[model samples]
Target chain A: MNEGAPAGAELLEVRGLSKFFGDVAAVERVSLDLARAETLGVVGESGSGKTTLARCILRAIDPDAGSVRFNSANGWTSLHSLKEKELVPLRREMQMIFQDPFSSLNPRMTVQQILEEPLLIHGERKRGKRVAAVREMLSRVQLGADALTRYPHAFSGGQRQRIGIARALMLRPSLVVCDESVSALDVSVQAQIINLLEDLQAELGLTYLFVAHDLAVVRHICDRVLVMHRGRVVETGTVEDVFERPRQDYTRLLLSAIPSPDPDVPLKPLDRATLNL
Target chain B: MTAPVLAIRDLAVEFKTDTGVTPALSGVSFDVPRGQVTAIVGESGSGKSVTANCVMRLVQPPGRITGGSIRFAPDAGDAFDVVKLADRDPRLYDLRGGHISMVFQEPMTALSPVHDIGGQVAEAILCHRDIGKEAARAEAAQMLERVGLDDMERRMGMYPFEFSGGMRQRVVIAMALVCHPEVLICDEPTTALDVTIQAEILTLIRSLQHELGNSVIFITHDLGVVAQIADHVVVMYQGRVLEIGTVRQVLKQPLHPYTRGLLQAIPGVVPPGERLATIASVVGDADIETPHPLVALADGRQVSLPPAQLRRVARS
Candidate 1:
């Protein structure tokens, strides 16, 4: 494995991954390898199977076919075939951050209870140790310990998202799947969260499966990006190659749709005839 | 410059919640020139929606307009004060759908699930136009076609639920424009849509604006959309105007620290390893004083910049 190169040793290998809902194939034969400490972005519009792929990888939803292998301390383990009881320990190595901060966290639970739930479920026996770990993780997310006693409703959207990030990092997972985590936030607040994510990744040496619909966001954070269209991977390349010199027409269309903030550069709307819809 | 079609001066709104009276908007003033788009850009809770609501006289009880005036001047009519009008006044009905119309963020909520699309649109025309049902329905179908809805004559009979997200939005636009209002207020109109759909809607709005020659008040948080559509831009933060200028001036040469921070904070423009500048980092613990001096650009665009910042820009 080359430490300096963009590609590192494979931390996760997903082969022939497929998920079907009724007659629709939400995800189809998706195969990819996530390098250790590398951020891989999956870009697609709604119904393109990006969310389905993330859920299948996390075992939140069962895939109809294919295997997900993770490189563990002991050896490689098949995540898809593992029984629910046996998969609990492996879950600590992989965690997810959801899209909506308002609904993701429990409204009834205090910040402490929300963050410590995973630890308690995973059998961390010492109460003092859990409190210490929770406090430390809160600081990592740039939140104060004073937030622990307060409910989710008390905090703003940005702060609630920070708590979500803190909860995901509680177990110190090597792989963090952020599923449109910053999409709902205001632009300024989104920037703050993105910066925090980058800082945390550097400090913790984390691998990220950054899934988003926004092309600009994917370009900013990912080393490599995969463009999915109609449940199929249309293009996969480095961020520069995918964004600057897209090989597929769909990718080009997606890129053009991104409204640039610069007033000097005007983008014409895609013509109906060109789309061939 | 031509006289503004609508002018908002020193507007103030307060929400009386259980905790206390929280001021949502204070001293917000702007003008909507004829045949141009003015975008009010802000983050959540920055009073953008409240300003729009005040224009339509839709601000409910517990959320009252404490001060200021909204002046409406139609092309060939006497000017009137919108703020002074009572909620139950008969004149408000004429102004709302006749002179001003609005499209909300969520199309599904704005439209009725039970009502057929054509009937609803026709009803809007009937409210102000004194037209017969047949003529109103014909105008509704024509408006739907104008908004680029396919098979408009048949699709008008279908309920809103039958339409996709993008299609539903088109229906909403058709209904809003059916009355042929002088001003259209679109609040985050494309926020819920996919990117391609957003582009299409934007194009539709631009083309419709050109064809109808109506002034537009575009409320959005995305600077990208503002850059694309707005002739003039107003940047708001925490219920106060940070800066207001022509699109080119504000986006190209932002002077206020908050405006500058917002421009730098967008992700795609920065490289992968580089950190994005944040608002908190730019304005730490210091409240920016209001009523900054307005600097006139070479192109006649006005930017609100503090004197110190203006001096710094001049030196640099």
Candidate 2:
């Protein structure tokens, strides 16, 4: 480990990450790291194992092999080997934002209930403090305190996403994995959520593992981006470096596929240089 | 002179929720030339999907096309008034998947799980165009083949679950095109798809549009897709037209702030070592109560009044 690295260095690290379902390899040899207060973007097509990587990181599903090392307030711990009970403290330090805001949230629970559940489960604070914390978080996400009474269905896709963010930030986790958090949102609303995430990150010193299929959104928000293909990290670079000087064929193809606003301007023809990486 | 393939004049759509009348679209106007791709691009709730649904007469209850005329110009001198026809009219049914067809987002729900792949496409062909079951099967196979599917015979008998998302979308496209409709409306057809598959589907749509000479209305939030396929572009915002122009004009040199923001947000444009531009502020950027006229930029392109200028009172 680099000695001069920040105290929150390597908030989460994946080494040789691999998962398989029957004959299909869902994720293979995928390695990435999330630094403290840094945003790491994971981009890929469906079946590219971006979600599986997220699951493995969150331990929502156990990986077949590999290690996930997380440096929390309690020091570094390997997440892959930890059982549910052993992982509880670590879970509190890391949270995930799901893709579909409508479906991921419980229909029965009010927004306040949803936000407070994690704090309650961790026994981090008393019920009264939890309510105050929930209200504060809601405010941070630009939601009203009165919204606490309403269920997720009452909110629009973008608003619901804000609630999701509020819930993720409730515990003051070392890292947050936003898995397609804005995919369901409209373009304008997506921008709002992206901006909110950025602001919260700055204010809270929160780190993000922003997973999404939309390269454009990833480009805007992510400090560093990893492009996954068929369950492996195919390309890794800063947003500008990876997008502008894509070193892989799949990356080039993805870049070319983005719907251009200019109908007359065909995608810049791919030269042989882009294929070698 | 030949009539325009699709003409919507002063179109207004509204949905009656418990909250009251929520206007979804108002005075949205445009025309799609035959054999061309006309893209309706916007953020969510921009009424792009609503407009497409209106074309199919598929807007569920609680939503109504309150006003507007939709005229469809078929081949030669043939023309049908779309808005005048009631949803129950046989002509609407005939037009759907016959004269005009649609490919929707989320093929899992769009395709029937109960029916086999072959049965579904065959049913579409047999429904409007009088054809035998065996003949329909052959045509379905051909359609699947045209959509770049291999081993059509075996795949046809399989249910939707067996196919991958991209393949299923292709099947949906095939179903839409099996009858050679005069118009194809794709509502975020590739949104659920992965990037590479999206590329393939986009390529397929572009090629098919060229080969079949069928007009297409592509409704998507993705500006890249509009750039790739659309000749004409229509940008919508909060139930009204924000801007309409050629794809080149709308995308490369976007006049509308929303459009420009969207384009700048794309990851591909960010130079190495630079952070992407994220537009901050409220969800609804446009003036909801009034029709915000798009102004002509210095470059002779159209742009909606920027959110800053339009929201001066709110900002203050």
Best by TM-score: 1
lDDT by candidate, in order shown: 0.88, 0.82
Off by over 4 Å in 2: A1-9, A268-277, B76-78, B86-88, B253-258, B261-288, B292-316
TM-score of each: 0.95, 0.87
Reference contacts preserved by each model = 0.85, 0.65
What is the CA-based DockQ of model 1? 0.76
lDDT of 2 by residue, B1-316 (tens): 4567899877888899988999898887888877789999887778998988888787788999899888887775567778889768888888888888999999999899999999999999999887799999999999999998888768989999999999999999999999999999999998888776787788899899899999999998888788888988888877888777787778776655666667776545655334446533221464444566555444444445656673542233
Model 1, B270-313: lDDT tens digits are: 77668877877776654565666456555555555667666676
Cα lDDT for residue A37, model 2? 88
C-alpha positional error of residue B121 in candidate 1 after TM-score superposition, expressed in Å: 1.3
| Runs in model 1 lying further than 4 Å from the true structure | A1-9, B283-307, B310-316
Residue B114 Cα positional deviation in candidate 1, in Å, after optimal superposition: 1.3
